[model samples]
Target: MASVDLGKVLDKAWADKPLAEVLAAPVSALKGVSDRDGELLDEAFGVKTVADLADLKYVRWAQALAALDAAK
Candidate 1:
């Protein structure tokens, strides 16, 4: 996949609409994410919205776990 400048798209969209609209938009619009990641995120975490990504406890835990694992 190609690189996507999500922040730029979001800034432009937010100027024309509500924050909810921007968040509800597809994750594909974001930068550097493959179709596979979107599908897996939707299935594994039910992360349909950008807002959902913020609330992912398992992801947060896993990130921390990876950091610890790498440090060892």
Candidate 2:
């Protein structure tokens, strides 16, 4: 899978968006996520947005990577 830049995914425009609103957005909103990968995230893991991706219980690796990538 390509590396996703979470900062880009959760752009400044979304700084004040509600968690639920962020979670409801399509995975495609995430940088470096292809349409297919987005589908897989939703189908395989029910990951649909930045909030979902931040969930450590299901997507630990993603959570870690997001932290690192977003920090940059």
Clashes of each: 0, 0
Per-candidate TM-score against the hidden true structure = 0.51, 0.47
Error of 1 at 12 (Å): 8.5
Candidate topping TM-score: 1
Residue pairs clashing in model 1 are: none
Across 1-72, the per-residue lDDT of candidate 1 in tens digits comes to: 677554665544344556677667655445555567778889988987666775689878898999899999
- Which portions of model 2 show Cα errors greater than 4 Å? 1-23, 56-58, 61-72
- The Cα error of candidate 1 at residue 4, in Å, is 15
Q: What range of 10 consecutive residues in model 2 has the weakest lDDT sum?
A: 6-15
Off by over 4 Å in 1: 1-18, 59-72
Model number with the top lDDT: 2
